[model samples]
Target: MSAVQGLIPQPSGLDREDDVLTAEGLTKTFGTRTVVDGLSLRVGAGEILGFLGPNGAGKSTAIAMLTGILPPDRGAVTIDGLPLGGRTARTAKSRIGVVPQEIALYPSLTARQNLRFFAGVQGLRGAARAERVDWALEVTGLTDRAADTVSSYSGGMQRRLNIAAGLLHRPKLVFLDEPTVGVDAQSRGLIFETVLRLRRELGMSVVYTSHYMPEVEQLCDRIVIIDRGRLLAEGTRDELVAPLGDGLLRWELPAGAPEAVRRELAAHGRVESEDTPGGTALVITAHDLARALRAVTDLAVRHRLPLTGLRLDRPDLESLFLHLTGRAIRDGS
Candidate 1:
């Protein structure tokens, strides 16, 4: 019943349950260009907040601010109730982990060595460090290859090692930026499986950023969509998908349609796509796809333009993202 009780599943390996982090009015800029505008978001204990946006849309900038890697020109970010504006940020960051888009490891070092170095940097040493190191290697399925040089490891193995390094500290909040980017299918599945295990075992609160929509759709507990340096919306899959206006009704019209006929068809739906070879594909969002289809059919017959194709698109996260951004997730931000 608490505000923080937002679908957090009961899990093991968590010591004390607590809200992991929050960001309010978070903003950043360089000269005249603002990369991340004022934005507010929340990540609960043991929750994964999927951060989604296109290129240049400030996804990375927001991550930088949230992790304290880059100071914000405005607003604030806090972790474990520690303010992001000062020394508290540093201390707070020690309890957090980051899996960068690029694998963060020494190419010449073995996976175990790299993990050990990070654990040491986190101030872990001796028995505790060794325990954590072995646990992380095992969890990420890198134990057998732990002695392999990072440069000699396959891309997928290297990625697993990168995550292993992050887990060595057992951070309360982990920032995963494109962690599975460019990895093979098997490795990607392992990465997601590892995330699930971590969430259950550690009750770890995580922030994930990725261009892969299906991955986000499947893995994240919730999503925050941003575009052009500003937040478009934030909520769980249903909450965000619910307000995507309506389902899509696409109708393919005959070729070389005149303006008057086009205008008539346009009344039934928005002209979403068109091609001379493929005719005009019109899209109208409506709760009743059937009724909308009938209306379009009337228009087609009235104008004598061929109504060749039609389909109903159910509302979904991908559709939601597209509705807000006016572009596909893969489109440039």
Candidate 2:
């Protein structure tokens, strides 16, 4: 019998050789609670996997297990074809870089000083260390401030440097755990550009975990969503949200539109749900907002009510999340 035929099906085998990482039935528990439960995932070379979930949905715990910071209570994991166990995972971790959600740089250390320290830890020295530090500074656009302490840098600058630090050794895989949080728009754009450049130029496998739906829509080739410690869904953004393509267009009927006003409006579009304090938010499947707007306005005029808000909302990640979980994407409960 084949090795995988006897054991659990390996997620990595879905791809050809050069699969960067895989997790099969990974589970982690604390006390009576299981943080990560039987989660299986795979990322091939040059693939960017976007991982997203509600808060406390085992995103961090699963990442910890995958990267060797925490042990799985059951199942198996591998990085760069090496089993994630014993000292093997530690050695494998050395070849992979992690940009954690929290900044790992020393506040008192200059950018160059911080890079040098990390270079030493990664077994880089002499000319290679200096070259890497210089290259990182240049790429992160911190060449002018390489001598300044991290405490002196702006939040965006610090984040850029944080990414540069992750790239010093050019690991085969990089996991970014919400690296864009708290960054300004410009910084966010820069980080996005830098991440894309890495995938385009160096063919690195990036596993990005974030709740920011738009970023995932823009950057990821495939997105795997987990909720309640289990895989909820996986596919391209279109594949996952395709059902929503036939979704509703929302509008707010100006205040004081009597209960009967909804009935009149129903002739044009379906009313999915409404909030009284905020006016009526009617939903119509696959309908154009412009036409809905005309109908809503005509009804409001007939009823002598005010016109409130109008929106054309497609079924994006947020809607898909709500569809699957019965609540907002940000709402864990």
Candidate 3:
């Protein structure tokens, strides 16, 4: 039998539960600083959970605790009803596959050779090993180039191969940390397709972390936002953003925009000004874009101030992140 046939358990028979992985009050500390402070979240079976946080928000620390790489100072992690640590730690670890942010392959080796090495570590041998290597190559769309050196593969191919290595044992849950980072558009799309396949075809739960807001917006069924090691919000995109009310209307004005104009814009809603490459931008939170646009245009015309540009940005994950953390996700990164 092929390695995928032997190693990959039939997902059709597996129980699909709402909570496949749960972390309750997970805390971690380093010397004097508590990195991950009382974190908690849940991932549903066959669901893509977007794990979001600013850099240094203890995301890495929290992930380490959940993956069994590091024990939490307080709190607990349960995977597939198996608690982490003690007799069940190994079993719990077995249920998870982690695709780290870094490339874990040896550039000198062929893609097939890398798979063989990882599969061997997982205890597959002989024909089983060969079958799994082939399966991984095929699933990652690298079968034709399986013989090629890792050094020759594009950034995206290398990333897909990284994911394939993680799936050798067919774990029920996967942790994908910035899987699409540093890859081209085509590679990003391919990675997305591969992840979707894991959920749709194999019924695997995924916890995906990324700085690219749109990727999470597109791929995740639900999102969990964290900052300073605390859970800020968790829900579908609409649920979290809807409470923040309507979107933002931004007006780009010349550097010396009149103070009167700024004060006038604030009367419509919460107005924030920042220096941009183009000019000074006034971002106004508005319930009605049409009225806000008319008001701004009228004010600009009355003041005879040059209006450089106007843009209406609908509420999105990025906006939600900003609303919750008071910082742009990218800026935090």
Best model per lDDT: 3
For residues 1-333, what per-residue lDDT tens digits would candidate 3 score against the true structure? 211112222112123356789888888888999888988788888999999988878888899998999999999999999998889999999999999999999999999999999999998999999998898888778899999999999889999999999999889899999999999999999899999999988999999999999999899998888788887777787776664447778788886767888887777767767687856888787767677888988988897866668877778888767756667776655
User: In model 3, how many backbone clashes occur?
Assistant: 0
Using lDDT as the measure, name the better of candidate 2 and candidate 3. 3
Score candidate 1 by lDDT. Answer: 0.77
Q: What is the C-alpha lDDT of each candidate?
A: 0.77, 0.78, 0.84
Rank order (by TM-score, best first): 1, 3, 2
Task: Say which prediction, candidate 1 or candidate 2, comes out ahead on TM-score.
Answer: 1
TM-score winner: 1
Q: By TM-score, how accurate is candidate 2?
A: 0.78
Q: After superposition, how far is residue 256 of candidate 2 from its true place, in Å?
A: 22
- Sort all candidates by lDDT, best to worst: 3, 2, 1
Q: Which stretches of candidate 2 lie over 4 Å from their true place?
A: 1-15, 249-312
* Candidate 1 lDDT score at position 159: 88
- lDDT for model 3: 0.84
TM-score of each: 0.83, 0.78, 0.82
Show how many residue pairs clash in every candidate, following the order shown. Answer: 0, 1, 0
> Local error of candidate 2 at 22, Å?
1.2
State the lDDT of candidate 1 residue by residue for 1-333, as single tens digits: 211112222122212336687777778888898888887777888999899987778888888888888888888777888886676867888878998888778999988899889999888989999999999999999899888899999898888898988888888899888888889999999999999988999899889988888898899998888887777776777666553335676667666766675565455444455454666666565655566677767767777766558666677777666656767877873
